[model samples]
Target chain A: MRADTEQDILKTELWWTALVTAVVTAIMLAIIYAGLVHHINPPSNIETVDPKTLHLTGEFTEGNLGTRVDGSQITSRIVATQFAFQPQCIVMPANRTVTLRFATPDVIHGILVTGTNVNTMIIPGYVSQVHTVFTKTGDLLMPCHEFCGLGHSQMWATVRVVPEDEFKPGPDGRVTCDAR
Target chain B: MALAPHPNYSAQVPPRVDDAVDDVALERVMREVPSGALALSLLTVGLLLLAWFLMYAFVFLPRGMVG
Candidate 1:
């Protein structure tokens, strides 16, 4: 109730407010820096496809699921079925920007590559795409994080990242783990 | 002498001891308590910020970029 007590409380409140603002500003700045400098962002590709006919035709056909290089662009397409990725293993060159496109014919599935920032959800009626450059040259586990069925734990694949010199494409410009 | 009527029982109740501090003492208490609380709050927030920055720099940054 005293003037001095009220003044002190007001000062403390002002200091706390300033500190909170500074912390929020610092977090925003950090996010902006990551976006501008490191190019880190969330995967938000929204392409639709019929879940029933996903495997029958188009880009998700069984024969077309793998790493394919078209000129300067490298793309890998995979279909997430009940308990496995179509191609159990995929080959990609390290330090190159690659697009990973995923679609699920059964249920909602999500994938996260170990030790990397690549994480996205593969919905049944839509395709999930992630663009990333793998820096580490090794096999990274890509596990289906969303539990779909009794075999969800076994639903995983391998991302085989090889050196640029070792990434050999076949005559059709497709690369697979078997050719390694 | 004759006993006084009713003996003034209501007046015999004791004053609250906690509220009897002088102005100077009350001022010191008000000042010290909030300052101590502020110090504790600042330390907690500082440690939280430190942990967040450490994770961002060491774990998240080195994981590489994806979009």
Candidate 2:
């Protein structure tokens, strides 16, 4: 036994435990907040498109199967068919907001960008749209997540996010990975 | 006057305790933690923070938007 001050005797182990728990909780909350506001995993916007005649006309035509830069926003159009994503290698500039538009002329399929939160279900007769900004410059692998057919394992694409200084768009506003 | 020692029982001696030596050993064990252990813990925390920051800035940020 040892002598103790009256005020010091009032403190207990519970106080220390609560303080430690509060610090841990605060750290977890901060991480979650940072993840939510950082625009890493964006939500998908779905719209109806006629699957039977999607290739006939409109923006999903074969000529517009890749990325097209508009006034301020960049739009990427992709057609997910039986076993491949048309224009497997799409190009975009890093650190810029981009609209990713996907449509399937066949059955339902899902797309997920590896190392990213960009995941959406590409269903026939509908368009899956996602708007996001690329912050890093590299090749991002995009694979079909949903099972479509026997060759589903081979259905994948690459998205090249080039640095803004290196991105070169042609007079027609078309960009592809091979252009680099 | 009426009590007698049991034949099966034997008197035992108490173990010797040196108060000064025992107190010193106890204080050394309980008073402070090793400086190396504390430094290692802090270093681990710093490394964890660094890894988290790098992953967030490079990997997560560059992957682009989902919504």
Candidate 3:
């Protein structure tokens, strides 16, 4: 009777162990596959833009600006600081596609374009790309959201959106501000 | 030996149990967390998430036209 009871207990423990091991293994495998495989082959970069595309390269650094007119401290907001490109001055054609790639010369930076609902983080060694379809013609602001250093709150970029015909033509027939 | 009065015959025994289960083994097993391991785990997870997002952008989605 004692041996039988011990055998039953051992069998129960063994079954539980097996079940737990299988569950744990499945979870680990799923995490690995999702992180390693999915990350290497994300779906965003495969899309391409047509000719006459505006290719702009921007570098962001930490700098400071004064407060607002109302005496409201603009420096208090996370989005108010840190910008390599002035988003408000970025001129783009309405009803067209635009691509913006962000890079940092020193530290990690994050670009947040509030008007068009675009956000991306850029690292020192990595180039982050943002693609947007500008369906409207208006002024916008692009601010840095990353908490880099003391000057992080002052980084700002300008974006200007103009009509398709009004875009300035580059020497290479590309509507780019910077030479490719 | 005859006791004069043992409290009440119908009264229950004292609440204090006669024996307690020792858990020294379990305690020893639980105290082995390595330093900075949690932070490292979080960093790993963040990097992994970033990699996955990039892959999803560059690979899985169709690259033809804007909807």
* Best candidate (score: DockQ): 1
What ranges in model 3 sit over 4 Å off? Answer: A1-83, A86-88, A172-180, B1-67
When candidate 3 is compared with the true two-chain complex, its DockQ is 0.04
Q: Quote the chain B TM-score of every prediction.
A: 0.68, 0.52, 0.37
Write model 2 residue lDDT over A1-180, tens digit each, in one string: 123332233343445456557657866775575568765444546579999888898889999889888777789999998899998989988878788899999999999877666888999988898877777779999999999999999999999989988887889888877777
On DockQ, the stronger of 2 and 3 is 2
Candidate 2 TM-score for chain A: 0.78
lDDT of 3: 0.47
lDDT, candidate 3, A39-110, per-residue tens: 312224332222121222222322211111112111101212134442223445555555565444456678
**What tier of docking accuracy does candidate 2 attain?**
acceptable
lDDT of 1 by residue, B1-67 (tens): 9877676776787865776679888788898999899999999999999999998899888877889
Q: What is the interface RMSD of each candidate, in Å?
A: 1.1, 5.3, 11.7
What lDDT tens digits, residue by residue, belong to model 3 across residues B14-65? 6667465455543433332322444565578657766766654563322312
Residue A166 shift from truth in candidate 1, angstroms? 0.6
lDDT tens digits by residue: candidate 1, A102-152: 998899999999999999999999999999999899999999999989999
